[model samples]
Target: MNARTGPLSDVRILDLTQALAGPFCTMLLADLGADVIKVEPPGGDMSRTMGPHPNDRAGTDYGGYFASVNRNKRSVVLDIKTDGGREAIFKLAATADAVVENAKTGVMDRAGIGYDRLRKIKPSLVYAAIRGFGDPRTGRSPYADWPAYDIVAQSMGGLVSITGPAGSDGFRAGPGVGDIYPGTLAALGVVSAIHAARRTGHGQFLDVAMYDAILTLCENIVYTYSRAGVVRGPQGNGTPVLCPFDVFRSRDGAVAIAAPGENHWAILCNAIGRPELIADDRCRNNPKRVANAEFVREAVSAWTTAHTTQEIVAAIGGRVPVGPVNTAKDIFADPHPRARGMLIEVDQPGDNPPLTIAGCPIKFTETPSGIYARAPLLGEHTEQILAEAGITDASKEKS
Candidate 1:
């Protein structure tokens, strides 16, 4: 852990992202051993003000939102508008394998350090972007200049059209999948672009539009409409093609049980002490069960409601696909997370206790990757990072 490690340990990245989408993407690179230097503006990433800050740890230094996505990276404050700051960024970019940013369409170009200008400094430098719509470099969007956030992306991307209960108004997802999915895709694009650059000695500009990513994530909708003339709508916890694949209420809470397959349906039927149900004409095949969805749902619900989550798991787990709808407390108490190292504990600066954030799920058998550093305080490594970039302008940093 002491030594520089990870699959991308040798790769340096100049990160100019703020808020969730950009930072989340760079964080993935940082987790995988990329030396990601987060170049923040004088005021810091906007997420610094977002909270769940500990009562005893209130400060401008950090907050929960920033900490969650900005771990394992260094921060360097820079005002892109300043002459010296732009010079410093170019110097950093000269040495970086890639540059990633989520600024509006023309913000970077207006600052004079956009991909077109940066690639001139390093011909083989990969430039990746995450935007609400998309950059004109790839394809012009009608709303390219309009500002957007997670909600905007989710709404415009067609996710909100088919998201909630089949009869009720659609709901945005609890998590920022609108941003997170695009960020995840951006990370993959960056790495792939870099791989091609290493081979061709030339880099390219790539982007992930938040709206585009969401549409891609909901791909089934497109095909359903195109192939069947059906505009898919949410069926709440179950889908139109599957019966007994909904969230069932246990005595204590809820668990999702998907037993649409023939063998699985048989196993679940026997487990519920109603083996005869499986052979019934109305439930004999997936299509029939789906057609009689209400009957299957009611029968399954009746069984699940009589049992606690644990009992339901004991009866159907491993034999069929079943999982409790866990809360944070439940996840903390669960042994699976611990065994898989899903939750990582990191040190906090003040009197607050150590904070636990999600760990990287990507596992490499030969190459090691993980969180190695806590989220940096604003401008905490300004001087150090500038020095490493061979830019002697730490004095010009305002924050």
Candidate 2:
């Protein structure tokens, strides 16, 4: 099953990205059956060195971080700083439907292979970039030149401002949402631009800034501040507007329970043996419950703490919006992921055992998408990819 098999099988993409944001965007395309050719420098993507490596596999070229996102793509080595390398990129772009990168503002332009140059070779190419701030062509920022990572974007974009415990400095999320959200948006932008280019016979440049994407994710802050002059603070686990919409303690672990609607609230009240609270004046409705949030929380917590996480889930899992806070261990033991195909196993390089990674979530009735190949060894497909692109001579230098 080496042949591509999804809706994007007809499309080809040149991936000149590294690390999370850029690679993640291209990964989505590859999973959807786009023939993504990853153009790597001689040393390969920096993430190849990042670990959670196989415990027994020594001298492995790549680790879980690289494997997780680079699946279903071919890799080619190129030293874009050289004439031969630049020529190879041009040749590849000429046959590609799109080019995606996550370099800083002027990095690609200085190398002489930026979107401006690539678009000339393939006028219908969708050129997309992911940056810490934004590309100057779209809108220049004062901090455009400054380098940023996940934490920086999360802080500057207002996500960290309204997260974590109330009355204290905000907490960074467990995952790199700053990069992931921006990457997800870039994937959407790429698909949209490709659709437009196919229709209009002209491609355009699109960019997703990490800071901007994070801001969009925290959109509620913008409207709340603008409409009511209210600077929302850290909300902790629960929102200020909704009562009984939080993670409560259980004997074994924690479970998230939300019953903000009238009917759900009544159902929850009966389930927790607090039926009289449904008619109580201070906690009768959603608004009143919000006003007396402490009382409501104590009431829910009192019942939840006495039972196990699974017990609470069993009581109201389907009737109300409730679920336990699941860790990786719990997820591995659960049957839902297995039924949904949300976990997949693929072999690794060297003598390592097969590794499991999260699977693609998008589902299609006819054209299903999934991981079909493991991540390539550094420049694994260089000769084949170059030949496919009709490039007879190209530099394979590490620089």
Candidate 3:
């Protein structure tokens, strides 16, 4: 059976977000059958210009960045500067379950689309605003007006300080957690508010800041600082408190191993043919491993170097929690991704190699999630969405 029945079937969302984070959130809702109408400014979203075209052919307002996160959603272009545009949005918000945007702080307020204004129009409306630091009253006063990206949040939220190694340069995590996480939180918040409205007939004013969300992504550091008065530094590979829990280069690629506790460590030691490690005093427990990490890592790396990634996984995985660090090809070829409906083939007439994105992640026994449509051509659904809002003036409208 096809995975089509979604959870948020009747919900409607006015999407004004762009780039990775905000779009990712709406994509989740859209995949789950939410009526997500992405409202772009007159020229359209900046993501359309971001590269990795469909088939290296004529650009059709498509970007790999845009395609990956935005699917099963309609598109609408509106110049909110015009009175007709503002009225169109007001009309949409009146009936919509939620409105989402990722503008710099106060931009929405200046444009007359802030939560305060929208809530007045629709009392039970949920306004989801994704900002860089936070809203004006939420401690991002200084940077509220300043522009930000994923790296900015990574640096300010303490992730850059703790990434990499002792001597390596500070770095951001591979993914844009700064934007994505906040957007995710905002989406979750919007749905929660919608649920509340369903029961109480009152919506919420929600704002998720990239800095705030990314900060939550690395919460252990905060507690560690508060309790022990010890600040964490650049740490590469394994977790600070665990042993044999890092990536190692195999003959071909790499593999990740995790020996979180003493039991797992003992099992790994046996697998590596170093049974004496269990009795070693300096390497006996977790605290000891944290103190003498370099020595233990060196010993483990040396042992792992002799085996293939798969061999190492077979030898220590499950028993000692080892796993192979796979690449894109590995993921595409893996049997599990196919079986679990995590990977799907999309028909693209304009593609040379064809477009295939990671499928919807939600899995329900009765209602499953799957891709319904590709990113729309610029303003493809402008009229369609406006019609849904019952707007008669198609030539002059904002969606």
Q: Which candidate achieves the best lDDT against the true structure? A: 2
lDDT of every predicted structure (CA atoms): 0.89, 0.91, 0.81
Q: Of the candidates shown, which would achieve the greatest TM-score relative to the real structure?
A: 2
Model 3, residue 351: C-alpha shift (Å): 5.7
In Å, residue 309's CA in model 3 sits off its true spot by: 1.0
* TM-score for all models, in order of appearance: 0.97, 0.97, 0.93
**Model 3 per-residue lDDT tens digits across residues 1-399:** 133378887899999888887898898888887888888887888898886776655645676777778778888888888778888888888979999988887788889978889999999998888888778754645677778899999888888888987666678888888887887788789889899999998988778888888778889999999999988888787787777678887776788877858889898888888899888987899888878888888778887788888888888767877677878899888798999888866554354454778887778776666787877777988888888888888546323
Tell me the RMSD of model 2 versus the true structure: 1.5
Q: Rank by TM-score, descending?
A: 2, 1, 3
> Which sections of candidate 2 miss by over 4 Å?
56-59, 393-399
* Between candidates 1 and 2, the TM-score winner: 2
Clashing pairs in 1: none
Candidate 2 per-residue lDDT over residues 1-399, each given as its tens digit: 267787899999999999999999999999899999999998899999898888654645888999999999999989997888998999999999999999999999999999899988889999999999999899999988988899999999999989999897898888999999999999999999999999999999999999999999999999999999999889889998998799899999999999999999999999999999999998899899999999999999999999999999999989999998999999999999988888999888778889898888987778888888889889989999988888765243323
Q: Which stretches of candidate 3 lie over 4 Å from their true place?
A: 1-4, 137-140, 349-353, 394-399
